[model samples]
Target: MDDDLHPDGAQDGREPRSGGANLLVFLALLPLDALVGGHAWLVVGMNGWAAAHNGEEATVPVTELVVSGGVPAAAGLALCWGRYWGAAVAQFALTAVLMAWLLSFQG
Candidate 1:
């Protein structure tokens, strides 16, 4: 077996470090999701209404709803399934940017 695959020297046969790291990423993002407030729900509602109306006169594309809701979800999933560190970094960066943007209005 490759040594690099088991950086923590797992001779006792245990799951890789990435799994725990991914779980941590998932856990960390949960609060960020909450901090996002009701925007996700609002996006869903808008998309649903627009779909029912055949998107006629819709101000935003349905894809916007998916993106608005998917970013955090995808980040979590990515951490679990793909690059754990990358996902964590991306999630933290996004959260910081969002929080900064929200706080910017407080003068």
Candidate 2:
């Protein structure tokens, strides 16, 4: 094809993506976001491990949960588009342990 004129595979731009590919990627990533958000919810809103395993009542106020957990996750999610997306991924990965560790200091 005339598309690959360059040996380096540069044909003025990237190849076109399929709509299904994009949708599939979004579907794949949805659980990751939900996992991060759920961890935040469990930590802040539901008062950590007890809520997850024992059905303990949520002791935290909604506003506090939003401020403490939601903001950091949002910041991490915002980094998804840039080179710093790794940091965002790390933030998501660390959300549960980090929050649990921090909140332990208060209790």
Candidate 3:
């Protein structure tokens, strides 16, 4: 089965590449960060637009959203080239931080 999958028997007698693992971690984390970051930006934009149209102050500050969302998204992208174990650890830490920050807004 392994041979059928590898085709050239390239899976034998070699350690897994850290770059491949890091790339996988990067790919997996990036979309999630993007999605949450995009939603945060959208919400902030809509609120700003509505506030401007109605002559009221925006409820959510743009800086807050950028810091909360942008940092993690950028970190995820940076992980694509980072050391394997380091990237994995940072991925978990960043994920936790992002989740906690998101949950803080819940009533």
Candidate 4:
């Protein structure tokens, strides 16, 4: 006669999980992150294109995009299987960072 709404805590039961759920969450986010990361990485490609086309260096924006996109995603992947709160916070921060990066690209 269990009464807990989840029976497994809020998400990861606040204890050691079997890693499946975290893996699933990671898989779910992988595509989205890859899409965004790929777009961000394209800044490098754009730099090459622009450099070849206009003979100018575009260093700062490319580096900024790579750092902003890659680091948080790597952090998110690293923390996805830690704890419930860890996962939640990582996901939230990841989303926020992604959104902020996306917004930054808007003209």
Candidate 5:
């Protein structure tokens, strides 16, 4: 056993390196963060379009923004952290909010 690599006397077969773990965590979060950030931008763009079309009024994109941004963001975060349950919950909440928005808008 490499004593230098196992300064803390960890019994694992492979020794741990702080740098390697940090790199792995960063790589894992990279994809998730990108996806969520991209979706956030999309939500913003869509809101802009809707607002512009609605005679420049300060319309809140509660539905579009929340569902589109929140679902993907939550899912991405959950995936990065290996939390399937959180992802599922986020999906359900987003769906419900979207449905409510749709029904309310159907006036």
Candidate 6:
């Protein structure tokens, strides 16, 4: 009996260079993470300012930026490391949402 799929066998007896592959993905997304981290810092500063001045603390991007940026970063890394072809698609889609949300903050 020939089995088409085996649980313990590598396809070519060679594991994918996941370290290198994941490094590329991380490098590619580093800029976005930097931006997200910067914005998070800004949000923290603004909230601190608001508290100091007794300004309205409502409607701030308390977790919007976190969710928009963090989810994509983590998910993209996992998906890329796992060799998922949809990694790019999901990453960019989340990027779009982030960008749009950022723009919303601008207004």
Worst 10 residues of 2 by lDDT: 57-66
Provide C-alpha RMSD values for all models, in order. 11.5, 10.2, 8.7, 8.6, 10.0, 9.1
- Candidate number achieving the greatest TM-score relative to the actual structure: 4
Which tens-of-lDDT digit does each residue in 4-105 have in candidate 1?
A: 455676555443346566667667777767645357445545655776689553343335444554666566566645557655666666655654443333
**So what's the TM-score on candidate 4?**
0.49
The reply for model 3, stretches above 4 Å from the true place, is 1-17, 59-84, 88-107
TM-score of 1: 0.36
Relative to the unseen true structure, what is the C-alpha lDDT of residue 80 in candidate 6, on a scale of 0 to 100? Answer: 54
- For model 6, the stretches where C-alpha displacement exceeds 4 angstroms are 1-17, 55-62, 65-107
Q: Is candidate 3 or candidate 5 better by lDDT?
A: 3
- Could you give the candidate ranking by TM-score, starting with the highest? 4, 6, 3, 5, 1, 2
Residue-wise lDDT of candidate 5 within 50-87, one digit each (tens)?
A: 87788775444566556655654555455445434444
Q: Give the backbone clash total of model 5.
A: 0
Cα-lDDT of candidate 4: 0.59
Off by over 4 Å in 5: 1-17, 58-107
Q: What is the lDDT of residue 81 in candidate 3?
A: 39
**Global Cα lDDT for candidate 1:** 0.56
- Please give, for residues 6-52, the per-residue lDDT of candidate 4 as tens digits: 76555434564445766666567667666766766576557667876
- Which residue pairs in candidate 6 have backbone atoms (N, alpha carbon, C) closer than 3 angstroms, thus clashing? none
Q: Least lDDT summed over 10 consecutive residues: which range in candidate 3?
A: 98-107
Q: How close is candidate 5 to the true structure, as a TM-score?
A: 0.40
Per-prediction TM-score, please? 0.36, 0.36, 0.44, 0.49, 0.40, 0.46
lDDT of each: 0.56, 0.55, 0.62, 0.59, 0.52, 0.59
